[model samples]
Target chain A: MKNRVRYTFILPALILMTIIVAFPIIYNLYMSLHIWFVASGSGPHWNGLKNYIALLSDKRFWNSIRVTIIFTVGALGSEVLIGVLLALFFNRQFKGKDIIKTIFLFPIAATPVAVALIWGMMYNYDLGIINVLLKAIGLPPLLWLADPKWVIPALIITDAWQWTPLILLIVLSNLESLPTDPFESAKVDGANSLQVILYITLPMVKPAIIVAAMIRSIDAIKTFDLIYVMTQGGPDIASENLNLYIFNMGFSYFRMGMASTLAIVLFTIVMAVNVFLAVIRNRDVT
Target chain B: MSKSYIKTGLFYIGIAAITILPLIVFLWMFLTGLKTQMDNLAIPPKIIFSPTLQNFKSVFAQNNFLKYLFNSFIVAVFAVAISLLFGLPAAYAIARFKMHKIGLTLLIARMIPFISYLIPWFIIFRKLRLVDTYIALITTHLIITLPFIIWIMVNFFENVPISLEEAARIDGCSYFQVFVRILIPVVRNGIFTSSVLGFIFSWNQFLFSLILSGNRTMTVPVAVFKFISYEEINWGGLAAAATTITLPPLILTLFIQKHMIKGLTSGAVKG
Candidate 1:
């Protein structure tokens, strides 16, 4: 009776998950193995490995992979570095600390689409605040989202602005929980603050940093709303990542099979990275 | 002593700078929302200007934004409420039974790219003639809210002392009775935290809504695009709409600031 009741307790949620979560994933896999286009008014026909074959040679697919890599590396790198630094700076007691921390939470809390819209306006060329500020500071304003060279960087800046705080919050919480003995011993050894931070604080918080990075990477690689709203993978598709590309294939073009293939690839990449990081985290623990 | 004082002063300045830097975009959005179109488009960008409610007026009066706001609210409420309903029991079972595999399954579901699900859902909903319905929107949004609620509440339920359950059992209380009359009251704060966070997430979700919801179920995030057209963009109206859409989550987060961090980090750190 006791054993059966536990399953009963979990039944509703498990049923809902299987229907909503598990079913769709299986359906997506099924779709990926077939050729179908909604616009053609034709049902799915089995065309195993062909969609995958086309994806292997598709130039646009490769471009999207490249763009995703650059965006992920750039955004995640800056976020982790700046976030860790901010966490360190904020570790000490200070005046108005809670208020300051609350202010930091605003970006994380705000709607992503709305956040993208505001950044879109700020990145405007002629009369945007960014350019106006640039001119005020005796610098020439350059095209931001319009220029291919600048689009990824501009997107990265906006991403960093909104998401860096997540890393900071995670790392800061880890830092607070850290043991004091190591730091006190390091101090007794006459190590400078920078040395202590470099050798002691950083190495100690390695697990938290890895976890933070893993979370950020997963979210960043699948970023769509910000890219779609701001650029629509435009300015010559310079900023189009896998998510946007898959969106175009599935929805805009109605190429369901191709889109499913792309999506499967993205899913594989995300899961691979997740497993890789979990391995590193486990290795560190043992 | 003077040198240390200067250092402290610089430290404060540094913290202030970093905090204010990101906030400037929001501040700019708010100020622009209050500006007249002429003032908004002015050269040198008017740092000081007589404000107007015209943008806000136009957003509601001209664009029918109230409908979208209603849609967003209804979807988020129903989604979070249902998640709580299903998630609470599952969370309790997972916590007490040490069902870590079920917990991991939910976590993987959360981690999957939403677009993968969107394709299959779009097709399925289209076949059922359920596209653009509240049912479709609410159901699709479960993918976001349900997993989150279970994860957070599982953590919350684990923290509850089992002795309390034993006490209730000894008093002839059944399992359901103990769970309801005893456990629910203890973790009411967890329920609040998960619900608020879950509501905010479902509220902010854009892609699923973008794909599944049509004109009848248009959400606030998708509605923000109405201010943009092919020829020109309504800067003031866009800002006004963006600012309005951002406020609910922003304000709710402020109320649960401490709990939000605990909720977010608990999954990653402890999982």
Candidate 2:
């Protein structure tokens, strides 16, 4: 009786998950094996591996993959770097520190669509504030979202602005919880601040930093709203990440089978990164 | 000593810049919402202007923004409420019984792209004639809120003393009764944190609602796009709409910052 009761406790959630999460994933797999276009008004018919073969040769698909890799690496690299530097700066006591921390939390919590929209306006060529500031500094105002060359970097800046705070918060929390004995000993040994940080602080915070990077990487690869709202994968598909490509395939083109295949590929990529990071984290522990 | 003072002054200046720099976009958004179109489009970007409530008035008067706001509220509330109901007991069971597989399953479910789920959900709901209904939106949002609630609550449940449950059991309290009378009260803070976080996730959710919901159930995030068209974009109206949409989550996050940080970093740091 005791053993069975716990199962009952989980039953409702299990059932809900099966209906909502499990069923969709299975159905997506099944759909990926078919050739169906909803716009054609014909139901799905099995065409095993054709969609996959087509995807293998799809140049647009490959471009999206490239874009995704660049976005992920660029955004995640910057976020971690900036986040760590900011966290180190903030770990010390200062005036209005708590208020500053609270302000940091606002960007992460703000709505993504709204954030994208605000950035879109600010990226405007003629009247936007970013270019205004650039002009004020005596630099040329580049076409931010309108130019293919500058689109990805522009998007990266927006993404970094919004999510860097998350990495900062995670690292800051870890920094606070660390033991003081190591720092005390390092000071007694007459080490400089940079040396102490490089030798002791960073190594101790490695696990937390890895975890933060992993979380940010997973979310960053799946970024959609910001791309969709700001550029809509425009300027000749310059900023179209895999997520946006999959969305266009499914909804705009109504090619459900192709869309499902793209989603599976994305799923595989995300899971691979997740497992890879988990393995590294586990290795650090042992 | 004089050099050290200079360093301290630079440090304060750097900290202030870091803190205030990122917030300029938000400040710009709020200020633009108060500007007339002429002021908004001014080349220098008007830093000082006679602010007007016209944009806010037009957002409500011209677009049916209040309805979208209501839709967002209703969907988020129902989704969070349902997630809490199913997630609390499941979290307790997983924590106490060492159900690690179940916990991992929930985490994987959370990590899957919302687009993957949106494909089948669009098909199923279309067939059921449930598109544009609250039922479809709330149910799909469970894919977000349920996993989030369970993941956060499991951490809270693990921290509770098993002795408390055992004592209740010895006192002739049934498992369900002990869960209700003892564990529920013990992890109320976790419950609050998860609910707030879940509600915010659902509220901010755009893709699911965008594909699944029609005009009748359009959310605030989706509604912001109405101010944009191919012909021309309504800058004042768009700014007002965006500002309105971001306000609730910003306010809620302010109240729960400490708990929210702990919740966000709990599993990531430990594992």
Candidate 3:
């Protein structure tokens, strides 16, 4: 009776989950294997694995994949590095720490679309304050969005700005919870501050860092709003990561079939990465 | 002693700069929202000027942003309410039954790109004539809120002592009764945190509202996009819209900074 009740308790969420998430995934797969553009007002025509095969050779698809990798790595790498450093700096007892820490939480929770708009204005070539500040320092103004070379970096910078706080928060929390025995022992063993951090603190916080990195990487690869609002994958699709490309394929062009195929591919990549991270994380935990 | 004092002073300055760097952009945006178009674009940018309410007036009056704000509120609130109705029991079950697979499933749902669900949802919603309805917007917003609420509340439920519920069950109370009478009372803080975070996520959601919703149910984030066009950009209006959109989440984060941080970092710590 108790077991039955437990299963019953889970059933509602299961039903909603199936309807909201699982059903769409299956339907997304079904759409991917057919020609089902919504505007056509016709039923889907079955097309086996042809869509997947075609995506293999699609230059734009490959370009999006490449962009996703660069963007994810660039943003995730910098965020982890800078976040850890900031966490270290903030671990100390200091005046005004409470106020500064509270303020630091602002960007992590702010609306992404709004943040993107703010960044877009700040990156505008002629009217932006960034260029104004640059010229004040006797530097030439560069086009932030109009140039292909700068677009990915610009996006990465914005993402890092917003999310580095998350990494810092996680790391700082882990740092606070770390056992003090090792550090105390190390101090008595005549260890310097740098050596203690490298040997003792870093190892203790490795799991937190990895968790933070994986989370940031997943979120970074799926970034859409900031790109959609800031650049819309412009300058010849230079910053067209997989999410925006799939979005354009579905909504802008209404190529539902191709878009669904690409979305499935993106989903597979994300799930695979997630599974890999989970395996590693579980092993570390055990 | 003097050298160490100088070092501490330098560290404070560094921390202050690091803290302010990300926020300077937002500060600029807020200030720009209060400036006229000319003043916004003025060379060297205006350091000090008489702030104006013109941009806020234009966004609210011309863009029907207040309607969008209402739409956002409706979607976020209903979705979160529905999520709690469904998610609390599931989280309780998962926490008590060691249903790790179910938890993993919800995590995957949380991580799936919003686009993967978009095309199918758009098609289905269109077929049902649900497009542009708050029903469509609220249902899809559940995709974000449900998983988050379940995930956060699962951890919270785990921390609740099993003895309390066991005692309630032994007293001839039904499982549901125990859940309501004992678990809910004990986990009120968790429920509050989950609701606030869930509401914030739903309110800030962009992609679903962008693709699935139309003029009737546009959200604030999507509505702000109206200020930009191929022909011209309304910098002042856009900033004002952005500023307004950020206020609720900002204030929420400030009010519950500890819970928000703990909630956000829950997965990482337990990992």
Error of 1 at B233 (Å): 2.9
Q: What share of the true interface contacts does each candidate keep?
A: 0.80, 0.77, 0.81
CA-based DockQ, model 2: 0.79
What are the clashing pairs of model 2? none
Candidate 2 residue A199 C-alpha distance from true site, Å = 1.1
Q: Which is the better candidate, 1 or 3, if ranked by TM-score?
A: 1
| Candidate 1: fraction of native contacts reproduced | 0.80
Chain A superposition TM-score, candidate 2: 0.98
- Give the clashing residue pairs of candidate 3, or none: none
lDDT by residue (tens digit), candidate 2, A127-163: 8888999999999998999999999999999999999
Name the candidate that leads on DockQ: 1
- Against the true structure, what is each candidate's TM-score? 0.98, 0.98, 0.97
Between candidates 2 and 3, the one scoring higher on lDDT is: 2
Q: Against the true structure, candidate 3 has what lDDT?
A: 0.87
Summed backbone clashes in each candidate are: 0, 0, 0
- Of 2 and 3, the candidate ahead on DockQ is 2
B1-271: candidate 2 lDDT, tens digit per residue: 9999999999999987898866888988999889998998787877779999999998888667899999999999999999999999999998999898888887688668889999999988988999999999999999999988888899999999999999999999999999999999999989988888888888899999889888899999888865665314568878888899999999998878888877876655444
* Model 1 per-residue lDDT tens digits across residues B1-271: 9999999999989988888877898899999899988998788788789999998888888666899999999999999999999999999999999999888888788679999999999999999999999999999999989998999999999999999999989999999999999999999999999999988998899999988888899999988865565314578888999999999999998888888888876666665
